[model samples]
Target: MSRHPDLQKFLDRYFMVFLAGYFLSLYAMAGTFSLVWSTYCRDCSREINYPLSLGVLVVTLVTAHAAVVRGRDWGVWMVAALCIGSVVFLLPTYGFRPHMGIFLSIIVVALLALLVLNSKRYRAMRVLLAEYRNKRQVERASKAQRPKVRRSR
Candidate 1:
């Protein structure tokens, strides 16, 4: 047997880690919003923004799936961009009254981003994914070039 690590297993574990971190950060954001909205924004007449939350969740999940399952680098970059965008956009929304939950979420996301960016295993998985794709392509090409053999009508 080859000594290389199993790519599927590694990806599965990585995805689990990503999910845990993502949900933790999401919980922090939700809790903070709940507390702040109740304390200060009760009279603002603003309802919870479900569309934005759903959009964020969908985008995050798709990018994570692409990165972990499809081994696409763009997915990783998208995740990073999302993280940075959240920090950039959210900080100013409070108008100099940032909550602890926002900070907590930011810190969690930052750590998650660091792990995604710095993991040697992820790098190795990318290489492996490329190699796997190349092998599949070669196999398809060779099969296409071969003459079809019909043994019996």
Candidate 2:
């Protein structure tokens, strides 16, 4: 029994969703900024357009939560990169000279990501979860089995 196999389908779907969300958000931000820049936001004002930033932050949080639930290193790093990039991009525009909030959020998010990715028990836990799920699948399959039929002479 492999925990990795057990969760593979779920992880795959989750990853697809996250990737889709990321790209969609990216395009949406481009469109929004273009529109804003053309019309009213040319002065580098209006708070650097934070709605998309907030959305990205929300998605990162969701990814981190999913990583915690699955104990997957891949998920953790993916989200960590997203968060770190966001902070780095915003820091300069936000006038963050030796900013405490910027540094603190990055550290907290990175540390949590590291803990999830490097946990000593994560692999074992995943294996156990897979084994348990496999057993349950087998039991359910057996319980749902149809009786074998014999051919008549």
Candidate 3:
């Protein structure tokens, strides 16, 4: 099955536009939260602070976007990593709350991560590892095949 040229063009354009907008919103949200709750964050631990949350979100967003743009199949892994990071941060911050909300949020994040991992476009983590390994192997082989030249003064 092939995509219509017009639809493809629209998707290509829309994707970048959507990503840019999404990132911009995240930035705004982070900035707003940081400024508005600066005092609260000051008293809270670093793990629960706005800056750490913002840093993780920005890093994950950029990384996931780059991974998806480079290899569509790798998008899920990026998503999974993001989800995992969210859960880890969340657990520490909210561990005291043995309430329904904390458990539900954790479940949702875990489920979302699982869904991404099992998506049709998903590729196994080993494939990425192998790709890097193969590249290194090729470089090593090429280097070994090259004749070494010695220079004497």
lDDT of 3 by residue, 8-70 (tens): 764664455434433433433343333334433546676556567667667866776565544
Off by over 4 Å in 3: 1-42, 45-49, 72-76, 92-94, 121-153
TM-score of the candidate numbered 1? Answer: 0.59
Structure candidate 2, residue pairs in collision: none
**lDDT (0 to 1) per candidate:** 0.58, 0.50, 0.52
In model 1, which regions exceed 4 Å deviation?
A: 1-53, 56-60, 94-98
* TM-score of every candidate relative to the true structure: 0.59, 0.39, 0.41
- 12-59, model 1: which lDDT tens digit per residue? 655555565456445434544444454455566555554565566666
Worst 10 residues of 1 by lDDT: 27-36
lDDT of 2 by residue, 100-143 (tens): 55444544544444444345444445455456667778898997
Query: Which ten contiguous residues of candidate 3 have the minimum total lDDT?
Result: 31-40
Winner by lDDT: 1
